[model samples]
Target: MNRRFPFDIARQEFGRASRGNVAVIFALAALPLLVGVGVAIDYAKSANVRTHLQSTLDAAVLAGARESSPSAQIAKAQSFFDAQRPEQFSAKTSASFSVADHVLNGTAQAEVPTSIMAMFGRETLDVSAKAAAASSSGGKVCILLVDQSRSQTLLANSGAKLIAPDCEIHVRTNVSPGAIINAGVNLDVKRTCVKASTVINNGGSVGNLEKSCDAISDPYAGKMPSVSIPGASCKSENYNPDVSTVVLPAGNYCNVNFSNQTSVTLNPGMYGGMNFNQARTVKLNPGLYIVKGGNWNVNSGMTFTGTGVTIYYADNSIIQFNGNVNVQLSAPTSGSYDDILFYEAPGLSQSNWVINGTSSSTLRGLIYLPSKAVTINSVSNVSADKATMVFASLILNNTNWTITPGNKAMASSSGGAVRLLY
Candidate 1:
């Protein structure tokens, strides 16, 4: 011990002291780490609560927007959050709604109490959500066809227009064109076709026409027309164009308004009746209307045009014609003639119609001259507008014919064409 031990004792003692100091230093470093782990666990719980609050709020807002009733929408939104989820997170929700014009708006809010963030003074986390959703007032149809055969009334509204390109025409009582007659009860024309009407044989004996016209008074509540025809009687009755016009019936039915005009295309169908109730006004642009009906009668006061207008009747639409022809309505152009044509039905024993045009008239479609007759009524201020067409034919079989001047009177497809598709 005196020789070797004396040389190493202090050094060995110092080495042991150093190892112990190193262990103490490591323990001190781990203390901060443990605290940090504890804080991270608390932060995670707070973050999850905030996220849950956000999701619940979003769901509630969407649900409120989809509700049709105000109270129900709000109740459903609150109930949804109150429902327990697998996450078992508790949330408080509030909702509100507003409706303006056709638009609806809704908002929702959700709050969740923080579990660990309270240590940092963030007592609760809040989230907000909102959502919005809209319906229109009009019918859109590019083409409307009217069958005038059995229909004795027509009422025209403002949105409807017409295109009839040909001649303004008139016919006499004895003359018959034998073409089918397509008419409307409340016929709507946006342009101008005042010259379109049935002319009686004797300006004195318009009993049948007066009766029919009288039956269906103007749904528009406009001034009644004078019954210039002798035998015309003033019968007190109402002819309703649309079922909605049963009230406020017009008493005296005499004059019909032919200011605005419209057109309809008649395919090969046999339509017996149609009505155009004047819910609104109608304006007719320059266009053509093709019609094929069994019998034809226009309600009071409608604008019908001749520029782009043609009445194409099938066989049975026109029964007989007896009236004067007014020629002033026809356009002034070469190869133009206001016309009424007759022919045998495609598949029938005998033809059904007797159509007639008086002033510079030409006719097309089916016309029965044998059993049917067409007449052109006389109207003052006759205009001889020539009649021409891509297809023109006239058939007459023992049908009377007459002529006179001054025959009066008378889109893109997008819901089918205009729009942003996608």
Candidate 2:
């Protein structure tokens, strides 16, 4: 062994050193695996942070959107984030906000620092979140439509206010100037520019109603009883014919229309189901018309005009004003006959309806005021139950309307859950 050459000994040493280096190579090979595990953990943490940030941002955005003021919205958003997480940890937080025509949109971003993964030279991971909210500052209006063609009085009796802070009054009527206009909001004669006559006070602030007296322009504006319903226990129980029966026991008369140009004036008496099928015209003189039984159906271009009329629907009584008829309800009751009025507007069909009521009368069904306003002038009590009253502006003149519990009342009190989105 001692007789070995120097070169041979060197070669053997080199081979041994190469074999030792295998361990180093194997360790180096596992470095990427460790890096991968660290990366996965970092990603998981980032995802968790992202979810949290996203949820918080969503809540904040929603809160901001509900607010009407844009500046307030921004403040609220910032407050939300501050309350959720500290600013110190939000070093790399990114946020953007914008508002356009009452619509608020925003986005949020943050960075999640990699803990174990940083040891492998990975510094941090990025996480982002976004949310949006919309604020509503649009105009809120309730159009009041009245049939001035017929002698109707627009009254403000209950504790009611206009739909908007400043509302414009417009009137164009086919009726004469004797129509009574009670002013509760304003009394400036100049403001009552509408071509109407005789504006009175409603014991409230007469804001500008007087100045806008001549504001409206347009015109004029049923019925029956028959046992047309079958499969019913009561006589008029389930009977809903196109024409319904209304009996004004003695001194009461109900309005009946036979055509648009022609109307049949009925006296206070009982009526069989009147045909509202072919553009019928009807007129009612004064007095109460009681519902004995049957449904009133309006089919085509029918018009029902009333001068002084009162209609009462018994517990089981129902009135179905069909879709095609243009019915005008006029009457002088304890409240105001102009409770339901209609005016002329562009693109609006003459086929509209006007309704009036006294103390605490419940109306059930959809009532569309296509052209004018739905004036609830009943100072004593009135309720529009299950109805859709549309107008340019909805006016709640001191018309005694309250929110009471029960199906017999309006969907009020239960949050006054009236949804008006125009």
* Candidate no. 2 TM-score: 0.32
- Each candidate structure's TM-score, on Cα atoms with residue i matched to residue i, is 0.27, 0.32
lDDT of 1 by residue, 105-220 (tens): 55556565665555668666665555543211111111111112322112222221122221111111111211222221111212111112442221111111211111111111
- Candidate 2 residues lying further than 4 Å off, grouped into runs, are 1-15, 22-29, 32-348, 358-367, 372-379, 383-388, 392-398, 403-422
Candidate 2 lDDT by residue in tens digits, 155-182:
4443553322322233333344423444
Per-prediction tally of clashes: 130, 76
Residue 359 accuracy (lDDT) in model 1: 30
| Best-matching candidate per TM-score | 2
> What is residue 287's positional error in candidate 1, in angstroms?
52
